[model samples]
Target: MAVRRIGLTGGIGSGKSTVAGLLVAQGAVLVDTDAIARSIALPGGIAMPALEAAFGPGVIDPAGGLDRAAMRQIVFADAGAKARLESILHPLIGAETQRQAAAAGEDAVVVFDVPLLVESGRWRAIVDRVLVVDATEETQLKRVIARSGWAPEAVKAVIAQQAPRRARRAAADAVIYNESLTLEELAQQVRGFWERWAKSSTR
Candidate 1:
């Protein structure tokens, strides 16, 4: 039996997490790549040794974990550094993601909450569908600032670095316009989506 996988993605502050949670409530299994990445970067975690060697001691914190903030600054400024870093982490993350998805079992509707799904073109082929949570760049900036306390310019920079809105939309099999939705409204939309797919997957 094959698990039906949905690749869910959105820009920062676009409420993708909320949608993921709602789908989980509807009995969907979630394979969160970000959480897996964080876990692998923890002290003595699987990716730490390779990270330390590739990026050097300076990239590791005193606690022995990868210093994500410092590494972010390094990679974003240098494409080669970013590529090198991804080479060390991506394979590890992909393996863990696959293991988790497999453990979710055959009947599960697995939702892969991938923040960079659009940028990672490979994900599009692996999942049965792409569900994008969308909002205007202005909406994204304001929401991120309000929630994360990030500077408006910093939020804009992240948005700029992501695959553009048009590209994400083009890749989407379904879209959740989250710019003005209340939590209840957002959950309703997610629930409807899950119902439709869950019903169809059985047939």
Candidate 2:
């Protein structure tokens, strides 16, 4: 049976994770593409063989998992490198995302929590609705720096690599402005979003 799939997305530190959690509490089946990607790049995982074959040992950590830091540096510095890495991972991610969504069964309201949904171009066609968790670049920088201890330039680079804030908003069917809202307030908004887009749609 065809399911109602929601593409939930946001830039780094936009509090997308919190929205995802709240949606799960509202009973959405969350198929997190990033989590799937990370798992497949782990030691002895499906994507590891291809990653090793393509990028070689230097991109592999001593524990046999992907050296994400090295891979990020390579990808950011070269568009071709980014494309090469995505070519390897995107197919794997799509397949796993499908597998997980299928496993959710016929009645599930599946949310595809994809951070790179807008950048990917294909996700808009794949899901029923696109929901963006939005924050200003300044807020994103402050939050990520506080949480991850990444330098401002590092966060800026990451933000630059993603779809622009305006672009993300344009891609969205619904937008959650997450910059200054409290958790309970955010949860309240998510509840409203859930009632309208997810739970009601399932009916």
Candidate 3:
């Protein structure tokens, strides 16, 4: 088998990261875009210079890392700010992701865990398969609230910004309905997908 890629996406608090860990356990090379983005926003990170230049010093913390909460407020409230951010980070993320992908060698199952894959549309042409981990909106609300200690309204706001459940489903080659499954059940599902995936499954 040659190298293959699976584009993984889900709404916030939809267990996307959990599913990603499961896939990694199944021998997939994981290229987590969000993690890369976070790394680049850290102090002295790759994206910091441009982010500081674009958004100014107020968006940086005393520790010199990105003031994520402030930036989140800016991006969420201002569409132009969001686009400016994507412009600054996307190219760097893409280049680094590709560089990591190139290191996978032959026959590797590369999983790109992108939270915004459905919303972005750019990943559609690149991946062999798209897998969406899904849950009901209410379930998502509850899970995030439970885990993050964020205000329910804040969680809802984030959820509202992401592509809807139906939209994500439409983009998927396979879907994992994660509304109420235990971790073991989810892991079983990932293992099943791993065993069954092949070039023949391409659309």
Arranged by TM-score with the best first, the candidates are 2, 3, 1
Model 2 TM-score, all chains together: 0.96
Candidate of highest lDDT: 2
Off by over 4 Å in 3: 1-3, 198-203
Q: What is candidate 3's local distance difference test score?
A: 0.90
Residue range 132-190, candidate 2, lDDT tens digits: 99999999999999999998988999999999999999999999999899999999999
Which residue pairs in candidate 1 have backbone atoms (N, alpha carbon, C) closer than 3 angstroms, thus clashing? none
In model 1, the worst 10-residue window by lDDT is: 194-203
Show pairs that collide, candidate 3.
none
Write down the lDDT of every candidate, Cα atoms only: 0.88, 0.91, 0.90
Per-residue C-alpha lDDT of model 1 across residues 166-187, encoded as one tens digit per residue: 9999999899999898889998
Point to the candidate with the largest TM-score. Answer: 2
Q: In model 3, which range of ten residues has the least summed lDDT?
A: 194-203
Candidate 3, residues 3-115, lDDT tens digits: the string is 28899999998899999998888778899999999998999898999999999999999988899999989988999999999999999999999998989865678999999
TM-score of each: 0.94, 0.96, 0.94
Higher-lDDT candidate of 1 and 3:
3
lDDT of 1 at 134: 97
